[model samples]
Target: MNALARRNPWLVVACGAFIVTLAMGVRQSFGLFMRPIGLDIGIGRDMFGLAIAFQNLLFGLVQPFIGALADKHGAGRITAVGALVYAAGLLTAASATSAFGLHLSFGVLIGLAMSATTFVTVLGAVGRVVPAEKRTLAFGLTTAGGSLGQFLVVPAAQGLLSELGWRSALIVMAGVVSLVFVLAAGIAGKPPEAEEEGPPQSLSAALAEASRHRGYWLLNAGFFVCGFHIAFIATHFPAYLTDKGLDAKVGAMSLALVGLFNIFGSYLFGAWGDRWRKNYLLSGIYTARALLIVVFVSLPLGNVTALAFAAGIGFLWLGTVPLTSGLVTGMFGVRYLSMLYGIVFLSHQVGSFFGAWAAGYAYDLTGNYDFAWGASIALGLLAGLVHLPIRDEGLVARPAA
Candidate 1:
């Protein structure tokens, strides 16, 4: 498998993309269930929000360890296990009867599953296989798979919700998630031992080196804001739309449009990263997000404005994955990318926890998402400024770990 991947690395890229599509597609669709599950399960939005918050929190918290396992072992083995666990989490979520049950199944179980299956492990796998020159584009392509899933699966999930109800829709989604195990065959090799120059750096050394790097933490801060923006919108946007008297379908389609437009955004930004300064690109993306939100909120509520905002935001979505992951690879080399990027992703998810939970908290307290939107705009601007000082230097520019 390793020999085959080395011979034609695009196969690995393709397989990695498909696995992400399944894992992330199903994960993204969980937002559609917020209203229905809240109604049927007799829980308030805060309870449901808390469960999803835990999901994001746990997802980020365990990522470094999971990425380390994939770095030491192989992404295929980890991904296969994640697929099974993901199926179990979804199935369990279907049968959940209370807040604790939802927390355990949807939050804890799926969170761990995502840590195993999503971008860290998958991008790490692709990073090892693809050469440095093409790496960002590959990462972009792979990341876009998740957007593709969002574009495709969200509407399907809504359809299932309408026709079969949330429980059965979750069950069907579980079946779809199980396919990732089969697709895991594509990313079947460990990081190549011969790739790095000079003496090999241990994982501990890599972590220590990254800890001391100023730019690394800056990347983490930027990603945290990114997570905050994403989780807040994905988890709560539908309900927010419904609150404005838009049909539920509008929300689902809005999310789907974000996915669809992001397909282009992810790819183009990735290609741009290979040529332009990534830090500038990142700053622009974050600043754009803040502006978009301001315009979105200022405009009167309607289907057209809602979908326009979705398209605008979606195009910029997930573009960060490739650029950020590429930066880690450039700075540290791909030998420990799974672990290093996983650590950064952990920060992102930490922000995700606050984003998901705080929105609910703000809503339950104030009766509107005004506070959340304001926070997102502020954080976005902060992220834009944070990226400016990052010295985008490569491994050769720094001392050996």
Candidate 2:
């Protein structure tokens, strides 16, 4: 550790927290623009959905490479570049007049930009700085920060849209994202030197090694379900609420509630992972999501019910983050956390693409969100079952003391 790292680990955490907050807040705000942007551009919801789907797809495809770069070099450079691209993408999105422009700005640019700056980069940096004993909790804290962004930014963006139009909101948000560049600078400090045992494996070898681990494959499969549930709800819930004759603000607040409650839930679950079987905890979270979605879909749609559902389901939202990342660190060690976690996140983004696009397509075909909701419930249950058999022990052999 350097003098700054040795003296002030909390400072590093704060820096990481700020970066996560900015990155997630901006990303989450994208949903607020969906309906308005579609109407203004004279495009259908599926067009906007496809654009966001491409964003998620590209985001996932590039994340592993970005992670490798971060692990090899440092997070600061990648984060800086991501912030710049993200800002430019948002600015371009604000001026978009056609479907192609929307796809270029929102899909390609924002998606590729987010690959560098989101949870993979921030969590990898946190995993590097925090001690082994407190790693899970540290992961929780950073994940909570991202959730906090979701909580704060979504409603704020909605309010902005209510006051100014969506285009103006995007312009303002672009300026705010530029601040991430400053936070990225704080992550320039060096990571702790790897212990002298054997040299760290090349990125390709490390990836190949993880590929052979059964637990890693299980983790990826389970995360796919998470992506499906989150993307479907986040992208389409507002329109769903409107379809039910509820106020649009209710939909926005539902998203905000998920973000708010998830802050505590993520921290609690993260701490639980450190003390219990992480795979079991993940299984429980998924099961809970299944039950919650069942009840949410069956209940009569109203403000009270929506808010209650949001809060209840919110507790399970993003609770997967710490445990997922913790599982990777536990199995592989933190030496290559960035690369390993990025590959896992790729599974998540692929699922996100399906979840986001499918909801719009299904709704357009059926004129209701019922099919998407049903799929979410089924996938959640499947995720729970899939993770039940994962072995959560470390990969390397331990010497007898």
Candidate 3:
């Protein structure tokens, strides 16, 4: 067990991959259950959407404090507690018979649990333990884990929703999440250090410095677009496909395809960030995303078209994760990586809250996702443009006296 803490990058990546597979996979799969749960509970889709929206907001809001705790303490124990809470939330969500119950279980509890177990904490640990250059690849691989989760879990969830009831599936998920507790211990290591490239800076100092950076604020702006894109699509795409008269299987496969393709995109993009100017590469990706969305909406709709769309979108999906994370560590030291990333993620969640809620609200209002998709396309272009002109160099610290 002690040997595991000896800076094993592969092990860290693997553990992060699996833990996110469970956490984000479960979160992505929530869309599959949305229709079934709504049908059973006699609630509107907006109710579930609002619950998920709350889940997104809460997940991001709590991450900074959790990251701070992991920075000060170790991620191992926080992850364990998070896994337990996640499992309990899944169980409680299963038993919920009211909207308020869903809000408490899925919205709040799982939100807090993910704050502990997901990217900000897990990847932060990986970034600290690995070399600086390796962080892009590590963050990429870890981000890919979320995509892989989306790919594999979506189908598994579709199968489960088809065979067992949603309630039974939730109960089964509770048991599966418990395994994260074990992985948590594997990732636990010494607290983060701020002196990777310079002498240590105080936490408050790090905060003040980051707060004053224009590039940092630009990064936040681009990340908000990313959050909006993912939240809207992940929470609503499956339902959107089915509403278009496509088979339910098509919806599941659409999500799965994104996951599989995103795995490659993430790894490739991560590798590229190491060699290229990350801001430039990020610009291209966002531009590509906009183009893809435009093409997707312009075409004649069908299973093949939907799948092709999914593949294109998936290739661009989560590719931003590694680049964004790596960019943060590149500019700032690793000491406060978790908390810093958490602040960025909070902006993302704010976008997510709107994305998830707006999709449902649009559907409730006019019975379609047109407005949401159009907004996403425009935002992609804006994000791409904003990423340009970012000064990606790290802060220059004074030479030690």
The candidate that wins on TM-score is 1
lDDT of 3 at 355: 91
TM-score of each: 0.98, 0.96, 0.96
lDDT of 1: 0.91
Q: What is the C-alpha local distance difference test score of candidate 2?
A: 0.85
lDDT of 1 by residue, 218-304 (tens): 999999999999999999999999999999999999999999999999999999999988888999999999999999999999999
lDDT by residue for model 2 (1-401), tens: 34575567666677777888888877876777888998898988888888989999899999988987777677878899999999999999999999899999999999999998788887877777777778888888888887898899889899889999989999988998899898887675545456312355566677777988999999999999998888888888888888789988998899899889999998898899889888999999999999998887788878999999989888998989999999898877766888899999999999999999989998889888888888888899999998998885655642211
How many angstroms is residue 291 displaced in model 3 relative to the true structure, after the best TM-score fit?
Answer: 1.5
Model 3, position 399: C-alpha lDDT score: 38
Determine which window of 10 residues in candidate 1 has minimal summed lDDT: 392-401
Each candidate's lDDT (Cα)? 0.91, 0.85, 0.86
Q: What lDDT is obtained when candidate 3 is compared to the true structure?
A: 0.86
By lDDT, rank the candidates, best first. Answer: 1, 3, 2
Better of 1 and 2 by lDDT: 1
Model 3, 226: alpha-carbon shift in Å?
0.5
Off by over 4 Å in 1: 394-401
